[model samples]
Structures are given as structure tokens and as C-alpha cells.
Target: MTALTTREQIVTTADRLFYENGYEHTSFADIAAAVNISRGNFYYHFKAKDEILTAVIAARLAHTKTMIEGWEREAPNPEARIRRFMHMMIANRAAIKRYGCPVGTLVTEMAKLDHVAREDANKLFGLFRAWLGTQFRALGCGADADRLAMHLLARSQGVATLANAFGDDRFIRREVALMEEWLTAAVAHATPRPDNRRRQH
Candidate 1:
């Protein structure tokens, strides 16, 4: 694989630091050191911390869009796509156990700082919400799609939070299994039952 460009390297390093350490705590020098670049090079690429923050958020948004779209293509149906999303936690259980959800932690930190880029950071969740909502809609959720999307998102965030707090792989697996069951129940409920009576409409 090709090495990341300097600017890309800075954003990549900053993204990890911002998640592992929190935006407020990760210094410009820290990112520079991670990328093996000088402070002058860093400043050349980014005039201020907020600029780096914007780049990080933008990178995250782009990557997340690609990821969900890939899931949409890989899975045969909406239910499968949604399951792929829930399975993500298990796929990255170790990271979630160590640092919590990256999106959750970074967005929460940005909000606490009242940083100007908070909304940009938050678009990560928004992207997932919208994608999940589309999947729910395809599952016949109709008017309730967004609500179901938010419901699953909220529950997953809670799982990530607790998983980090407890650092338990078993907990993550158990919660994910429960989420799958929830999805099955939701789909069943959304699917219109066949009726024996003639059309009322």
C-alpha cells in the first residue's frame, strides 16, 4: 500500500489521537510526533487546531460514507445491511473495549468543548442514522423508519459505552445477539401480516 501524504498523515494521526486521547487533550505537537513531521510542516498543512479538527471530521465522514455504502452493496437486503452495522461492534470489540465508540467519544468531547466543529464531528452519527433509517424503510418501517433507526443507534451507543466501561467481550457479544433478536422482532412487526378477509380498502 502507498504511504499517506503529509496532510493525510496529519489528519489520520489526529483522528486516532482525538479518539484515544480526546480532542481537548491531543496537542498539535502530539500529532506531529505521531506523523514524524515537524511543527512547521504541521502548521503549513493546518493553520490552527480547528483546521485539523475539520480535516479529521471530513475524513471520518468520507470514510463512513464509503463503509456504509459498501455494506449496502455487500448485503443482499436491508435487514442484512442493518445486521452488518450491528455486527461492526463485535468486529471491533477490542477497540471499543479499550476506547469506547470512536464517534461517540469524539462527538461527546467536541460538544463539551463547545468547539466550532462539533456539528461536523457529529455528522458521523447523522450519516449512520440516515443510512440505518433507509434500511428500516426498506424493511417496511415506513413512517417509523427514522425512529427505529435512532432506537438501534441509541442502543448500540449504550452497548459501546458499557463495553468500554467493563472491557468485556462477552458483554459485547451478548448485547449484539440481543440486538439481532431485536432486529428480527422489529422486522416481523413491520411486515404486514397476510389477511384472509377481502380487501377493506
Candidate 2:
């Protein structure tokens, strides 16, 4: 595999540090040390911490978009695609247990800090919200798709938070199973509009 460029290395290190340590807590010195680069070199890549944050958020957004598209290609249908999302809690249980959801934790930290990049950070959640909404719309939720998406997102975030707090893998498993069941019921009971039905058929 190709090596990451110095700029990429800096952003990548910052992303992990910000997720593992709160954004306000991670310093340029910390990221520089993690990347094994001099602080002067770090300044060349990122003049300020906020700049690094913007790059990190952008990287996350791009990675998330790619992941969602991969899920669409891999899953057979909307229900299955949505299930893959719900199953992410189980898939990343170790990380969630260690640090909570990356997006959730970052947003919470930014909000508390009253940081300028709060909106940019929140776009991470918006990406999931929009993708989940698309999946629900395909499953015939109509105008309720975004609401359903938010509900599922909220549930996942809550589970991640509690799982991190308690370090409980069993809780993660149970929650993931419950989400799958919820998705199945939602898909079964949904009544698509006539136009939506025609489109599906």
C-alpha cells in the first residue's frame, strides 16, 4: 500500500487523537509527537488546530460516504442495507466500548467547547441521517423517512454512549438485535405511496 503524505499523516493522527482524546484536549504537540514530526513541520501542514479539525472532518465525511455506498452495493435491498447500519454497533463494539461513537463523541466535545467547527463536525451525523433517510424512503416510509432515520441514529448513539460508559459487549449485542427487529417490523408495516409502489415494482 502507498504511504500517506505528510499532510495526510497529520490529519489522520489528529482524527484519532480527537476521537480518543477530546478535541479540546489534544494539542499540536500531541499530534506532532504521534506523527513523529516536528512541531514546525506540523505547522506547515496545519497552521491551527481548527484547520486540522476541518481536514479531519472532511476526511471522515468522505470515508463515511464511501462506506454507505459500499453498503448499498453489498446489501440486497433497502431493509438489508439498513440492517447493515444497525449492525455497525456490533461490528465496532470494541471501539465503541473504548471511546463511544466517533461522530457522537466529537460532536459532544465540540458543543461543550463552543468550538467554531461544531457545524462542520455535525455534518458527520447529517451524512448518516441523510443516508438512513434514503434507506427508509426506499423501504416506503415516505415523509417519515428522516424521522425514522433520526430515531435509529439516536438509538445507536445512546447505545454507544452507554456501552462506552459500562464497557458492556452484551449490551451492544442486545441493542443491535433489537434494532434489527425494529427495522424488520418497520419495513413490514410500511405502506408505500402508490407512486412509490409503482417505482419499486
Candidate 3:
């Protein structure tokens, strides 16, 4: 295989180290070693581990946004669109099972030490929540759209954290199931119950 370019090597190595270890535990030395570059050469591309981490965070954010957008496009209706969003999260069960949402993980771990990192993390969460708010409104989710949007975001991240910490599939399955149930309730509650719609005897 063609060797990965230096920048790609650095990013790939950083991604793995940061995900497996953490932003705080990972260091410049680890990155240099992982990329097979000396410290001097590594410094040529990145001044500090923070710079590399910023790049890694940016890349992950872009990747996530693109994935969520693609899922949105594939959705056929408001409810499916919402369920698809949840399923898209379910698809990440493996990653969640391993590393958790990188942005959420990093923010919790490094937010105090790194303002820039925290800002980037906030951007990722804000984008998802905003997109969800717009989607819920589009689906006529009424006054509860905002709350429900926040709830969905919280539940997704919370489950990912639990999965990562506990190393259990039950967290992933149960959380996604709860999200699906909530989506159904939200949709039903948003719409007026028609008198013509009769209940089963």
C-alpha cells in the first residue's frame, strides 16, 4: 500500500490515540511515535498536541455532520426522518461501544483545560440540536419540539457514554429503543386526536 502522507499519518495516529486514551492522556510523543516521525519532524507540521487535537476534532465533526445529513436525505417522511436519525445513531453503536462520541467525550474530559476544544465541541452539539429542532418543527412537533430535540441529543450522548464506560450492548439497545419510543410519543402528542379516529373496543 502507498504510504500515508505525513499529515494523514499524523491525523490517523492522533485519532486512534485520542479515542483510545483521551485528549489529556495523549501526548506529542505518542503521536510522533505512532506516525513514525521524529519529534523535530512532527513539530514541523504541528506546534503542539493541542493543534493536532483541534484538527482531529474538526475532521470528526465534519464526518458526523455529513453522516447525519446523508441520513436526513434518505428519510421518506417526518417520522421516518426522525427514526432514521435515531437509527443513524444506532449504526454508531459499535463506535459508541468502544470510544463514545468523540466530541462529547473530549468536552467532558478537557473542556476546562482547553477553551478552544470546548468551543469546537459545543459547535458539534449545537449543530445537531439545531438540526433536530428544525426537523421537529417541520414535522409539526409543536411547543415540545425544542424540549424533545434537546432530550434526543442528551439521550444519544448519554447512551454513548454509558456504552463506552460500561462496555455493554444493553445500553445501546435500550437507549435507541427509548429514543424510538419517544419519537412515537412526540409525534402522536403533536397531532390532534381526531374524533373520527375510533379506538379499538
Candidate 4:
């Protein structure tokens, strides 16, 4: 195995700590200890704990984006894409049920703690939401595409929270199934009619 670079060490340690311990609970010292580095060396890579957390958040978002791309590629239509999104969310049911959505979890817990961190977290979420909205639009999901995008995110977070609270994967799977049903109905209803009118029959 290639020896880890300093930047890699810092980020890998931060990611592990952020996941194992809550984002709020993990400290720079914890990260340093994890990597067997001095606090000063940690500071060389990250000026503050918030900086490390921001890096961790960015890495996590990138992983999630890759997952979304995989779903988007395989899903043939808006409705199917929506169902695939539900399945993706449920794929992490057990882990999300245990620790919650990583981005959602960190943002909810730490966004308000610092200005820079909050802005970084907000941008991450904006990118995620926009990606979904754009996919819905590309698939010709109708006028309510933006709303559906938001609803999908909101419902996924709710399902994760419920799963975490109950310490059970059942609720996570159930909510994802419910969201799939809701998406199918919504997308079918929203598909433009032959007359090109917004009114439903």
C-alpha cells in the first residue's frame, strides 16, 4: 500500500472521527490522535476543527453525489429515477438508522456553531438539492419538479431520524417504500397532458 500523504492522513482521520463520534463531539485532538500526529501537524493541514469538519463534509457529499449519478444513469424516467432515489436512501438504512444522514446530521448539529462551517454546509446541501431538481427536470418531471425534489429530501431525512430513534431498520424501509409510492403517484399525475394544460383530469 502507498504511504498516506499528510493531506490524506488528515482527511482520513477526520472522516473516521466524524463518523464514529458525532461531528459535534469529535475534536481536532481526537483527529490528531487517530493519525498519530501532533496537534501542530494537524493544524498545518487544517487551521481549525471546523476546517477539518468542512473537509469531512465535502468528502461525504462527493461520495453521495457519485451514488446519485449511478442511480441517474440506470433510471430511465422521472418516476423510475424517483424510485431509484428512494432505494438509494434505503440502501444505507442500517447505517443511517444508526447515525443519521451524514450531511444532514452534521448540518443539523453544527451549521449554527460557526459562520464558515454553516456556509460550507449550506452550499453542500444546495448542490445536492439542485442536482436532484435538475435530474427531475431533465426527465421531464413537470412543473412541480422542484417541489418534488425538496419533498424527496425532506422525507428521506425524516425516515432516517425515525430509524435512528427507534434503532430499527423497519421504519426506514417502510418510509422509503411510502416515498416510492408517493413519487410514482406524483410524477404520473404531473406528467403533462396532451392538451398542455396544468389541470389534472
Candidate 5:
């Protein structure tokens, strides 16, 4: 594999550090050291912490778009595609229990800091919302697609936050199962049933 460039390395390292430790808690020196580069070299690449943050967010956006595309290719069925997103919690439960979710934590930290990149961080959520909305639309949700997408995003974040707080694997598993059932119900309700004009109540 081709090695990541210096700037890419710095941004990648900062992304991990910022997720592991809140943005404000992690310092320039920390990221520099983590990347095994001097502060001067780090500054040469990322002049300010926020600059690094912007790069990291951009990288995340690109990576997420690519992932969503892969999901599209891998699961042509919208419901199955949506399940892949939902099942991430169960698949990454260990990390969720430890870190609360890389996206959620970063977004929350940015909000609390009133950081300039808060909206940029939010666009991460926006990506999921829009993609899931498309998937819902494919499932024939029509006008309710975006709302259903947001609902799923909200539900997953809530589960991630509480799962982190409680570190309960069982709760994570149960919530995932419930979310799956919820998706099935939503799809069922969204679809138009065949006419039952002749059937008795």
C-alpha cells in the first residue's frame, strides 16, 4: 500500500487523538508527538489546531462517502443497506462501550466548546441523514424519508451514549435488536397494502 503523506499522517493521527480525547483536551504537542513529528513540522503542515480539525473533518467526510458508496454497491436492497448502518453498533460495540462513538463524541465536544467547526462536524451527521433518507425513499417512504432517517440517527446516538455510560453489552445487543425490529416495522408501514375490499374485518 502507498504510505500516507506527512499531512495525511498528521490529520489521521489528530482524528484518532481527538476522538480518544476531547478536542480541547488534546494538544498540538500530543498530535505532533503521536505522529512522531516535531512541532515545527506539524506547524508546517497544519498551522493551527482548527486547521488540523478541518482537515480531519474533510477526511472523515470523504471516508464516509466512500463507505456509503460501498454499502450501496454491497447491498442493493435498501432495507439491507439500512441494516448495515444499524448493525454498526452491534459490530463495533466494544469501541462504542469504550469511546461512545467517534462521530458522536467529536460532535458533542465541538458543540460544548462552541468551536468554529461545530457545523462542519455536524455535516458528518448530515451525510448519514441524507444517505439514509435516500435509502428510506427507495423503501417507498416518500415524504417521511428524511424524518425517518433523522429518527434512526437519533436513536443510534442515544444508544451509543448510554451504552458508553453503562458499558452494558446486553443493553447494546437488545437495543440493536429493537432497532432492527423498528426498521422492519417502519418499512412494513410505509409500503401500501393490497386492497382488501372483499375480505371481512
Candidate 6:
């Protein structure tokens, strides 16, 4: 693979730092030190910390979109796709235990700081909400799709918060299994829309 440019490296490092250290707490100097670059070179790439934050948010948005798209392509059906989303907790259990969900913590910190990029950071959650809603709709949830989407998001957020507090991998595993079981029951109860039923017939 090709190497990331200096600007890309700055944004990536900033993203990790922002997640590990709150946006309000992390300074440009911190990033520069982590990247082992001079202030002059850092300013050449990002004139201010806000610019770095904007770049980080944009990069995260693009990465999240790509991930959801990949799930859509690889999963055989909507239920499987949703399962993949739920399984993310188990997949990133270590990180969740240490730092909490990256998106959740970032958004929470941004909100607390009253940061300018709070809305921009929140778009990450919006992307997942929309994608999950689509999967629920496909499963014949119809008007309830958005509600179910939010419910799943809230559940995951709660699990991440508790997991981080407790640092329990077993908790993550149990929650993931519970979520999978919930999805299976939800799918069984979801009546196919008229058009979908006709198509199957």
C-alpha cells in the first residue's frame, strides 16, 4: 500500500489523540510531539486545532461510510448486516474497555465542551443510524425501522459505557449474544411488507 502523506498522518494521529485525550485537552503541541514534527511543519498542514478537528471528522465520516458499505456488500442479508454492526462491540472489546466507543466518547466530549465541531462529529452517529434504519426497513420493520435503529444505537452506547467502566470482555460477549438473539426474534416477528411477500410468492 502507498504511504500516507504528512497531512494524512497528522489527521490520523489527531483522530487517535482526540479519542484518547479529549478535544479540549489535546493541544497542537501534543499532536506535533506524537508525530515528531516541528510546530512550523504542523502549522503548514493545519493552521489551527479546529482545522485539524475538521479534517479528523471528515476522515472518520468517510471511513464509517466505507465500513457500512462493506457490510452491505459482504453480508448475505439485512439481518446478517445488522448482526455485523452489533458484533462490532465484541470485535473492538479491548479498545472499548480502555477508551470507550470512539464515536460515542468523541461526541460526548464535544457536546460537553460546546465545541464548534460537535454537529460535525455527530454526523458519524447519523451515518450509522441511517444505515441501521435501512437494514431494519429491509427486514419489513417499515415505520418502526428508525425507532429500532435508535434503540440499537442506544443499547450499544450503554453497553460500551458499562464495559469501559467495568473493563469486562465477558460483558461485551454477553451483550453481543443478547443483541444477536434480539435481532433473530425481531426478524421472526417482522411481517414482510405486501410487496416483499408478493415477491417471495
Candidate 6: tens digits of C-alpha lDDT, residues 1-201: 122588899999999998888788899999999988889988888889999999999999999898887887778678888999998898889999999999999999889989889999999999999989988988899899999999999999999999999999999999989999999999998975432322121
Which residue runs does candidate 5 get wrong by more than 4 Å? 1-4, 192-201
Which pairs clash (backbone N, Cα, C closer than 3 Å) in model 1? none
TM-score of each: 0.92, 0.92, 0.83, 0.81, 0.91, 0.93
lDDT of 5 at 11: 89
| Tens-digit per-residue lDDT, 32-105, candidate 1 | 99988777877888988888889888999999998977886677678888999999999999999999999999
Ordered from best to worst TM-score, the candidate numbers read 6, 2, 1, 5, 3, 4
Native-to-model Cα distance after best TM-score fit, residue 16 in candidate 6, in Å: 0.6
Off by over 4 Å in 3: 1-4, 191-201
lDDT of 2 by residue, 1-201 (tens): 123599998888899999999888999999999999877877877889889999999999999998987887778777888888988888899999999999999999889989889999899999999988988887789899999999999999999999999999999999999998888899888974332322221
Better of 2 and 6 by lDDT: 6
Score each candidate by Cα lDDT. 0.88, 0.88, 0.76, 0.71, 0.88, 0.90
Clashes of each: 0, 0, 0, 0, 0, 0
The candidate with the higher TM-score, 4 or 6, is 6
- What TM-score does candidate 5 reach? 0.91
lDDT, residue 181, candidate 2: 88
User: Which candidate tops lDDT?
Assistant: 6
> Which stretches of model 1 miss by more than 4 angstroms?
1-4, 192-201
Tens-digit lDDT track for model 3 on 65-160? Answer: 887667566665557767877876577778878888776877777676756677776887788788787778766776767888899888888888
- Put down candidate 5 lDDT per residue, 65-89, tens digits, no spaces: 9888877777747888899998888
Which ten-residue region of model 4 has the weakest summed lDDT?
Answer: 192-201
| CA displacement after TM-score superposition, residue 147 of candidate 4 (Å) | 1.0
CA lDDT of 32 in candidate 4?
80
lDDT of 6 at 100: 97
Predicted structure 4, TM vs. truth: 0.81
lDDT winner between 3 and 6, please give it.
Answer: 6
